[model samples]
Target: MPAPATPEAPAGWDFSDVVGSDSSLRRFLHGLPGVDQVGAEARAAQLGTRSIKTTAKAFALDLAIRMVDLTTLEGQDTPGKVRALAAKAMRPDPSDPTCPPAAAVCVYPDMVADVKQVLGDSGVKVASVATAFPSGRAALDVKLADTRDAVAAGADEIDMVIDRGAFLSGRYLQVFEEIVAVREACTAADGREAHLKVIFETGELQTLDNVRRASWLAMMAGGHFIKTSTGKVQPAATLPVTLVMLEAVRDFREATGQMVGVKPAGGIRSSKDAIKYLVMVNEVAGADWLDPDWFRFGASTLLNDLLMQRTKMTTGRYSGPDYFTLD
Candidate 1:
C-alpha cells in the first residue's frame, strides 16, 4: 500500500503552491481516484472510431510527422545508422518536400554526440535515454553521471526511466528525489537545461491506477514530459495506458496550472493507430495538448506509415515500403 499524505508541501513545488510533503505526497497519490479499466477502455475505443478524412487527415498526418521522435535504440546501432535515421527525420519523404521533419531523433546516451553532429542545423532535436535507460537499477551517482554525459554530448533532451523497483515497493520519495536530481543534471554546459522526459515503462506498472500514480509522480518531480515506455518492453505503449497518462497530465494541469507533454512509445506502428491516439488527445487532454511541444510519439516504423498515407493523400496512390528509406 502507498503512504499517507501530510498537510505540508514538499520543497519542489512550493513555488507552484502545490504542497508536496512526503506524507502529503503519499496521500495525494494513493488517494487519487482508482481507474475504471472498463470505462477507460470503452472511452478509448469509442474515440478511436472518430473518422478523420480529407483535410483533417492531411493535417493529422503532418502533425503526427512533426510529433514523431524518430527513434533507433538498438544495441547494434552505429554512426552510419544514426546518420541515416537523422536524415529520415529531417526529410521524411525526399520525394515530397512538404512533409515536415520529425520532432527529434531518440538514441542511446553514447550516440548523442554523433546524432548531434549528423543532425546539425536541421532543427531536429537529439534525445538520449539515460538514468540506466531500459532499466533503472543503477546507483544515483551513476544515473546522474549518465544524464550529465548525455547533456554534455549535446543531447537537446533527456529521457530517463524511473526506478520502478523503488516505486512499486512504495518508495515514492526515492523515485521523486531521483527525478529531481536528474532534472538538475539536465542542465547543459551552455546554461540550457535539456528537456527532461520521464518514462514509466507502464507495461510493468501492471494497472491503470499505477500508470496514473506514476504520471502524477513524474509531473510533480519536474518531468517536462511523461513517456509511456522505453520501446524495449513487451506491451510497450498501449491505448489504455496512454489514455490513463493523458488524463493524468490533464488533471495535473488543472490542479497545478502547469502543462507537461506526453509521449507514447513503442508498438504504435500504423497511421491509423497514431490517429486514434491523436483523437484521444484532442477529446481527453484538450486541443491545447495537440502540438509537438506538448505531445510526441516515440516510434520508428510509424514514420513510414505516415509517409505512405501522406503520399496517398497527395497522389491518390499508396506508396509501397520500397519507396520510403529504411532507418
Candidate 2:
C-alpha cells in the first residue's frame, strides 16, 4: 500500500515503494488498467453534446476565464507583449470589472520576472514553461537549471514537459527521476517551491494507455498538476485524452487521498469546448476539480472567445473578435 503523505510528497500520499527501482516502477505502471478507447471516446462525445442552462453557461464562461493560463510561448514573445498579456490577465474585460481575471499568465522562463512585475498582488499567478519547454530533449542538469532559473525569477508555477523519448523507450525510472529532479528545482532560496505542472505531450504518447500511465507517473513523482500537452504538438488536448486523464486523477485521489489538477492545453479555443471540459470535470472528478486551482486551459486565444461569450450572455449580442485586444 502507498504511505501517507510526507514532506517530499506534499499531496498527502507517497509512492516510494512503487518508485523504489526501475523494475518496480515499470511493473506498477504497466500493471495499471488499460484504457478502453471506444468507451472513452463515446463518453467524451456524449458529454460534449450536453448543454447547460443559460445561468450555468454564464457561470462556466467566467469559470473558464478564471481557469485560463493565458499562454504565449512563441519565439517572438517580447517583454512588452507579456506585460500587455499580464494586464489582460489581471482585467480580462476592462469595461466590465465584473468579469473575472484569468488564473495565470504562462510564458517562457526569461519573461517570468516581467509577468510578475505586472501581476504583483493581483492574485494572478506567473507560470513559466521550463525543462526545454515544448521539446523535453535537454540533459538532466540543463532541465533542472532551466527550472531553477524560472523559480528564482519569481515564477509561481513551472510547467515542465516529460521526455517522451525516455518514456516510450521504457526508461520509466529515468523519466520519473527527471520529474522528481525538476520538482526539486522549483524551490527558491527562501524555500517556496513553484507548483510543478508535468506535461506528458500526450499526442505523441500515441495511445490512451500511455496517457493513463503518464498521468500516474506524474502524480506519483509529485507533480502538482498533470497536463495534457505542451501546446506545440499537433492534436494537442483532445477530449478523449483529457477524459482518460480525468479518470486517472479521480482514481488517484481515491487511492491516495491527494488531488492533482488537470490542464488541457492547446486546440481548445471555443467557449463551447471549454464548457464541455467543465462538465466532464464535474462528472469524472467531481465538483472539487471544478475550481480554477484544480483545473486550467493553456490557450492564448481561448480568453477572447470566453470574453465574447460572456458579453453575449450579458448583453444579448455577440462581440466581434476585433472588440478585444488581439494580444
Q: Give TM per candidate.
A: 0.94, 0.96
lDDT of 1 by residue, 104-130 (tens): 999998999988998998899999999
Residue 177 displacement (Å), model 1: 0.1
> Which candidate ranks first by lDDT, i.e. highest?
2
lDDT of 2 by residue, 1-327 (tens): 121122223345678778889899999888887777888888899988998998888889999999999999999999999999999999999999999999999999999999999999999999999999889888889999999999999999999999999999999999999999999999999999899999999989999989999999998899999999998998899999999888888888877788899999989989999999999999878999999899999999999999999999999998999999997
Candidate 1 clashing pairs, residues 3+ apart or interchain: 4-27, 5-23, 5-24, 5-27, 6-23, 6-24, 9-19, 9-20, 10-20, 10-21
Each candidate: how many clashes? 10, 0
Candidate 2 lDDT at 75 equals 97
